[model samples]
Target chain A: MNFDIAIVIAIEMNIKVQNISKSYNKIKAVDAVTFEVNSGELFGLIGPDGAGKTTIFRILTTLLMPDEGNATVAEYDVVADYKAIRSSVGYMPGKFSLYQDLTVEENLEFFATIFGTTLAENYALIADIYIQLEPFKDRRAGALSGGMKQKLALCCALIHAPKVLFLDEPTTGVDPVSRKEFWQMLKRLQLKGITILVSTPYMDEASLCDRIALIQKGKILKIDAPQVITANYEKLIYDIQSKNTHGLIHDLKNYSSHYSVYAFGEFIHYIDKNVDFKPEDLQQYLEEKNHSDIIIKKAETTIEDVFMDL
Target chain B: MVFETLQVSIIIMNKEKIIQVEKLTKTFGNFTAVKGITFDVYKGEIFGFLGANGAGKTTAMKMLIGISNPTSGKAIVAGLDVATQSDLVKMNIGYMSQKFSLYDDLTVNENITFFGGIYGLSRKQIKEKSIQLVEELEMQNVANNLVGALPLGWKQKLSFSVALLHEPKIVFLDEPTGGVDPITRRQFWEMIYTQAHKGTTIFVTTHYMDEAEYCDRVSIMVDGVIEALDTPKNLKQQFKVNSMNDVFLKLARNIE
Candidate 1:
C-alpha cells in the first residue's frame, strides 16, 4: 500500500506526548500540548470551540504530527508504531465516514471483517449499539438519522474490541438524549477495561468521564474530576433575568460586582467580582436599580460556567 | 419537575398543540430508531428535540417533517397527518440541518432566493423577505458574500430565517447549534424565542444539556426508544436530577 512516511512510522505509540506544539504557518493550531491516557479508563479532552481539542486528538490518533514533540499510544510510539496504533485503537472521526452506500449491518460487518473479527465474537461488547441499528441494518448508512448513524459508528468502533477507543466529538451534532445514551454506553465500555479517550467541544460531557483534562488553546487548563473542577470554581453565580434582559447584560458587565457576566440560557449568569456581597444584597441592588420583572436566584456552577470563570 | 415555574394554568391546557405525536415508530429492518414516542408541541412554543447521540430524536423529527417515513403509529404535524399529507406538511414546514442547508458556493442573497423560490414564494416576496431577513440577522454586511466564508453560527441563524420565509407552521432544526460558540448558541435561542412569539413553533435538536431546560417539553431516547417524554421539569422531578444532564444520565443508565 502506498502511504506517507508518517503513516509508516505510527505504530509504537503508547500514550506519550511531549512538549508538542504545532502551527499552520502563523496560526498556532496546537500550542505546547502534552498529556497521556493510561492503558484503561475513559479520558476526556473537554473544551469549547477553537480550543484545539480536535487537533490533539488527531495527533494522538496518528493522523497528524506535531511540529515538534514525541508521542505514543498503547506502548507503540505514535511514529515508530504507527501501523500498530492504527490497528489497536478503534477510532470514529467527528464526521461520519462509514460507507454511506452500505447498510448499517454491512458497515459493521465490513469493519469487523477488516479487523479480522466476527460479530459473534464481539457480540456482547457491541450488542447494545448493534441492536439499535439492527432494524436499520439493511438501511443505507447515509439514510440513517444522526443518532442512528452515531450508534452504528459506535458499534463499528467496538467491533474490533480495541484496547482503546478514540471518539472525536462523537456527540457534537447528536441530540441531548442521544448524547446521554452515548455516554452511558461509554461508561459500560470503560467498565470492561478498555482505555477510551474521547474529545468533545461540549464541556457538559466532561462530567461523564472518570477524569478529564480541560484544554484551551492547546494548553491544559485543568485536569481533574468534573465535580472537583467545579469545586475549584470560587465565584458565586447568579442566574439573573429581568424585563430588560438586553439592558441587564450591558449594565451587569459594568456593575461593580461583576466578576464575569455571560449570557446563560434565559438569563445572564452573573459572577460577583466582589465575593463578599450576598444574593439578597444584589437582588436589592437590582430592585433599587429599577430592574423590572427581575428574578435573581443563586445558581450552582456547571462545567461550562466553570470554563467561563477560569 | 423541570421549568414548572413557567406557570401553566388550566387556560394553557385548552389550546391545541400544533404537532401531536403518539406512539410514533420508525423501524428499519428490525431496529427501531424511534419507538412508541409521544409528545405535543403547542403552537408558538420553543419545543426542544433532545436525546443522546443515537436516541431517535432525529428519526422522530424526520418523520414529522416528512423526509423519512414512520413504520407505524400516528403523527399529526400542523394539523395534517404526516403519513397522508406529506406534501401539505412540507408546504407548511421548513427544515434546517446541523450542516446548515445552504449552498456554500452561492452568495447569501442568491441562497435566499434559491430557497425562497423552491418554497414557491413569488419573486417579489423573495426579494422583500431576503432584504427583511438580511436586516434582522444583521447580515447586511454579507448580503452578497459567499455563504461558505461566513461563520457556522451566522449560517445557522440565516438558515433558520430562510426556513421561515413562507411562514411555516413549524420549523424543524436538526442539531442546528453544532460547532458554534456559546454566545452564538445563546443568540440562536433568542431567535427561536422571537419566532415562537410570532406563533412559529420552533422544533430544535441539540446536545447541550443546559439548552434542554429552555424547551417547552423534552423527550429522552434510549436504545432506540423514547424512554422519557415530558417537560424538562417533569423529567427532572421524575428522575430526581438537579440538571438536565443528570436527569439524562439517570434515565439512560438506570434503564439498563
Candidate 2:
C-alpha cells in the first residue's frame, strides 16, 4: 500500500513473506519467518523434520492460513486472494497423495481437468517428466515405484501451468540416482521461467538450489547461497580417521583441546577450542592410545555442519 | 569402556558367526524378489545393506527376520536355521522397522513396559532394565511424558533401545535414520557403534550412502541381486569413485 513498497513489488518478485507466524494448540509451528524469491529462482527450505518447512509451504500454497503476518505468491495475497493463489501455485505434498486406484495417465488427466485445463494444452511443460511416466501409463498409481510416483506427482502439479511450484520433501525417500535426475528436471523447469520452492531433508541437495533457508525448530537460522553459508562457518575443522573408529571418537572426546566432535560418514569432524591447534598433537595422542591406520586432515564444512554450529 | 573390554574378550574367544545365508532366493509367481543372494554376518559387526528403492532389500530382510519364507535357499541366524526353525530365529533377533515402533499415545515408561512385556520379560527384570535404559539414553527427565511429546530424535533413540530390550544376538534396522538431522544421525551411529562393541551384530539397511561408509562391510543390491559386496574402501576403489554416493550412482545407473 505504501508508495516505496509498491515500487519494490512491481519488480516481479514471485514470492514474498513478511513476519509470518503459525501455531497449533500451544506449539509454534512457524515463527516470524520472512523471505523472498525472484522470478524463476530455485529456492530451497532445508531442514529436518519438525522444522516448520511444511507449514510455510502450506501457507504459501494457500492450503492453510497463517495465524499472523502476510505472504503473497505471484503478487497475489495468500489470505485475501486464496482462490487466485491456489491456481497460480503447484504443490506436491510430502506424502504421495494421488488417487491409488487410478492409472498414471488417468491421474494426470484428473488433475488437469480439475484445474480446468487439458494435458495437451500444457503438454510441453510436463513433457520431460511425462516421458519417464509414459512407459507405465496404464499401471495404477499405487503400484508405481517411489521414484516413479514422485515423477507422476510432479507432472500432476505442473499440469495446471502454475507460475510457481511448491514441492515438500520431494526426494526424501528416493535413491541417489533418482534424486540427481529429479534435480535435473527442476533445472530444466527453471529455464522455462517457473519459480520453484522445494523443501528437502538432505543437506547434500542444498547446493542444487540457487538460495536456501536453513530452518530448525520453527525458526529460520540463515538464508543465502549454500556456498556462502558453509564458507562462513567460523571454526577450524578436521576429518579424523583411525583403524578403530569407535575408539577414535571416544579418545577424541577425552582430548583436552577438542571443542566439538561429530561423526561424519566414514570419518569424524573435530573442532578445536584453540584456533591454532596442531593436527600432529591429536595424531600423537591417538597414536599413544594404540590407534592405527590414522588419517587426519583439514576438512571442508558442509551445510549440515553450519546448521549444527548455529 | 565395558563394551570395549567385552569386545576384546569376544575376539579372544574367537569371532562367531551370527547370520549365515547360502543361495537365498524368494519369488512371487514369476517375479523373483531375491535372486539367489548369499552372505554371512559375523558377530559384533555392523553390516550395511545398501540399495536403491525397489532393489528387493526389504524382501531380503523379511526373510532373514523370519517374517517371510524364502522360496529357496538357507539362512542360519543366531545358530538356528531360518527355513525350518523360523520361530526360533524370530526369538533371537531384535527388529526396529523403518517406521520406528513406538506407541505414540503411551507414556515413555508405559511404552517400555509394553515392549518389555511382549518380549516376555518379567516385571522385576523390566523394572530394572527400564531404569538403566532411561539413564543410559539420558531420558530420565521425560520418563513419564507421552512418547508423542518427545522430539523425533529422542523417539528414534528410544525405539532403538526398546528393540534391544530382549538383548537378541543381532538387531535388524530397516532404514533406521531416515529423515533424521545430521547431528542426531551422528548420535544414532554412535549408538550403533556402542551396540556393536557390546557383541551385538548390527544388520542395517539404508538408502544413505554416507551411512554405508560407517559399516564394517556393505552389500549393494540392484534388482534383487547383490551386484557388489565389500568394504566401503574397496567398493570405491573398484568403481573408481570418490564417495559412496558416486559408487551407488554408478551402480544404479547401470540398471535399465
Candidate 3:
C-alpha cells in the first residue's frame, strides 16, 4: 500500500493551469496565469488584494469560467468535470461564508450531509483542528471570537476528506499568534497526504510554503522556493539604523548612491546604485546629517524585498 | 534656522495630552472586555494599539471613540469627557477602518464631498479640498470613477484622506494597511507620518509587526489587560528580543 501511494504521488500533478485568463468588465483579473501543484505539496499564491488570487481559485474550483485557457484539479477538468472536482476539493473562501446563525456542530454536520458523508466517518481527518473547536460546539458561530470563527470555518472545509484544499487569504487580518497557529495546522494537513493551495497577502507566510508565486496586478512576478527567490536577488541590501528614524529615511532617500530605501522592521533597508559602495562613505554622510549611533550592516534579502523589486 | 528652533521648542513646551484614560473598564453582563486599562496619548504621537483577536482592543477603541459607553472608568478625548460628551468626542476625532470606510456606489469626488459636508465644511472649502486631494493622489482621471472600481491601495489612501477632511485632533485607524501591497503599505505610512508632522495625533492598530516598529509607542493587550506599553525599541530591550514580532510572540503566547 505504501509503495502504491508513492507511485501515485510521483505520477500525479494534483493541479495544472495553462495560461488561464479571467476578466471582469474589460479589466483583466487573471492574465495568462499558469502554475501546477504536486500531490501532497503546500503551494502558496502570494499577493496583495485584487491580485487575481481569488479569481484563479474560483476558476480552479469550477465556480467561475475563465475567459481563456484551461485548468485541471485532481485529473478532473475544471470545465467538463466540475462536479467531480467539487466533491474532491475543499475550498475556504477569503470571507467567512459559513452559516453564522447555526451552532458550530450543526454547521459541520450540515456540510457533512451535503457531501453525502457522516461527520463520524471523517472526524479523524480534521481531528487536530476540530479538537480546538469542540469546546465551542454548543455556541453559535457568530458568537465566537475571530480566531475561533476561523478555526470553525477551517473545520467545515475539512469535514469531508478532500484530496486537495484551496484556501483564499485565510490569514489576511488575523493576529500574528493566530496566523502562526494556522500555518502550523496547514503543515499538519499536508502531512496527511493532502495537496494544499493557499493564498495570502502576508509576505512572511510565503516562506512557510513549499513553493510560492509572487503575484501582483494579475501577473506572476516570480515563482520558486522562497529561499531560491531570495537567493536570486542580485543586490547587496543594507540594514541601516540610527536614532532619528524619520530623519534617517529622509537622508537615505536623498543619498546619491541610494537605489531603494524603505523601513524594514526596526531598520531601514537600503540598496545602493553604485557597484562599489562602501559603508564608511554612507556612515560619514549620515553623521554629517546629525544621525547619531549609526549602525550599518549587510542585510539578508527576504521574499518581501524580492516582491518589491519585481 | 531660528524659526525652526523656535518651532521645535514650542512643540516641546506644549507636550499636550490629547487623550487620557484612568481605570477604563467595560463589561457586557458578566464578562469584562476592558479590565481597568489606563493609558495616555499625546498630541502628534503615533500610538500603536496591539492585541490578540479578542483581547478587547476593539472594545477599548469603541469607548475612546465615544460610540460605546463604558461600564466604569474615566476617559478624556480632546479636552472632553467621553462618557458625558460623546457627541462632541465623535466630532473631534476622525475614524477609518479597513473593512468599511467609503461608499462603493459613490464616485471618488462624491465621497470626498459627502465626508466634507458631514464634517460641516463649507461648500467652497469642500470643492477646493476635493480638487487638491485629487491632484495630490494623482486620481484626476479617475475622479469620477466609483470608489468600488478603484484598486484596494487607492481606496485605502482615499479613505485616509477623507478621514482628515475636517482636520480632527486625532485620527483612529483600525488595520489601515491590512492587505495592501508592500510599496503601497509604506506609502500609507508615509501619509501617516506627514499627518503626524502636522500635529495630528494618530492612534492606529495593525497586525504587521514591522509597522508596529514605526510607531512612537505601542501597547500590547492580552486577556483584557494592558500587558506591556513602551516604544518598540524599549519593549524589545525589556523583553530581550531583537524584533517587535518576537516581543509580540512572547507576550501573546498565552492565548490559543
The candidate maximizing DockQ is 3
Q: Distance (Å) between predicted and true CA of A149, model 3?
A: 1.3
Measured as a fraction from 0 to 1, the native contacts recovered by model 2 come to: 0.76
For all candidates in order, state the fraction of native interface contacts they contain.
0.54, 0.76, 0.83
- The TM-score of candidate 2 is 0.94
Candidate 2 structure quality by residue, lDDT tens digits, B157-183: 999999999999899998888788888
Query: Of the true contacts between chains A and B, what fraction does model 1 have?
Result: 0.54
Q: List the residue pairs that clash in candidate 3.
A: none
Error of 2 at B219 (Å): 0.5
Looking at model 3 chain A, which ten-residue stretch has the lowest summed lDDT?
A5-14
Worst ten in a row by lDDT for model 2 chain A: A4-13
Model 2, C-alpha of B246: deviation from truth (Å): 1.2
Clashing pairs in 2: none
What i-RMS does each candidate reach, in Å? 3.5, 1.1, 0.7
Candidate 3 positional error at A209, Å: 0.5
Off by over 4 Å in 2: A1-13, B1-14, B254-256
Q: What is the clash count for each candidate, in the order shown?
A: 40, 0, 0
Q: What TM-score, computed on C-alpha atoms, does each candidate reach? A: 0.76, 0.94, 0.97
The DockQ scores of all candidates, in the order shown, are: 0.34, 0.69, 0.79
* lDDT for each residue of candidate 1 in B112-224, tens digit (9 for 90 to 100): 99999999999999989999999988889899999987766788889988888888989988877777766677778767777777788888877777787777678777766
